[model samples]
Target: MLGEMHDVLHEFPDLKDKINELHDNDAEFAKLMDTHDQLDDKIRGLEEHEQPVSDFHMEDLKKQRALLKDQIYDILRGLS
Candidate 1:
């Protein structure tokens, strides 16, 4: 489970419609999601491939991903 995918849609299945609508119409939301996905990819790659990186760096990336998820959730909540 080290490299598990944390896809936004998967994370918030109930908000799928809202997420897609925002992704299509809101550039900022799309960008944030894109960055989150990129971070997830990086983290997954590091863990899956056993890439060498400091623990602090890995923790920092995870923190950033969590922050992005929270921001996305806040946006979804406002709309939902």
Candidate 2:
């Protein structure tokens, strides 16, 4: 199992209420957050266990996750 958790709620505990509001009310935000969490899970699983994916693919996944995080952060930061 992965040793670390990088979920949105974990990353921004202070913005718990805001995150919940957006997650429940904003369809786009919810979709992006869902995607981010899925990517996190995939990346962590790949890291802990061997997989057939190439180094490049793994890096690409990480990059995608980072972008999603930035987008989510921007939204949260604007309100907070």
Off by over 4 Å in 2: 1-3
lDDT (tens digit, per residue) of candidate 1 on 1-80: 89899979878998999999999999999999899988999999999999999999999999999999999999899942
Note the clash tally of each candidate: 0, 0
TM-scores, one per candidate: 0.93, 0.86
Task: Please give me the total number of clashing residue pairs in predicted model 2.
Answer: 0
Query: What lDDT would candidate 2 get against the real structure?
Result: 0.88
**Candidate 1 residue pairs in clash (backbone atoms < 3 Å):** none
Each prediction's whole-model lDDT (CA): 0.92, 0.88
Clash pairs detected, candidate 2: none
Which structure among the candidates has the greatest TM-score? 1
N/CA/C clash count, model 1 = 0
Query: What lDDT does candidate 1 reach at residue 47?
Result: 98
The deviation in Å at residue 77 for candidate 2 is 1.5
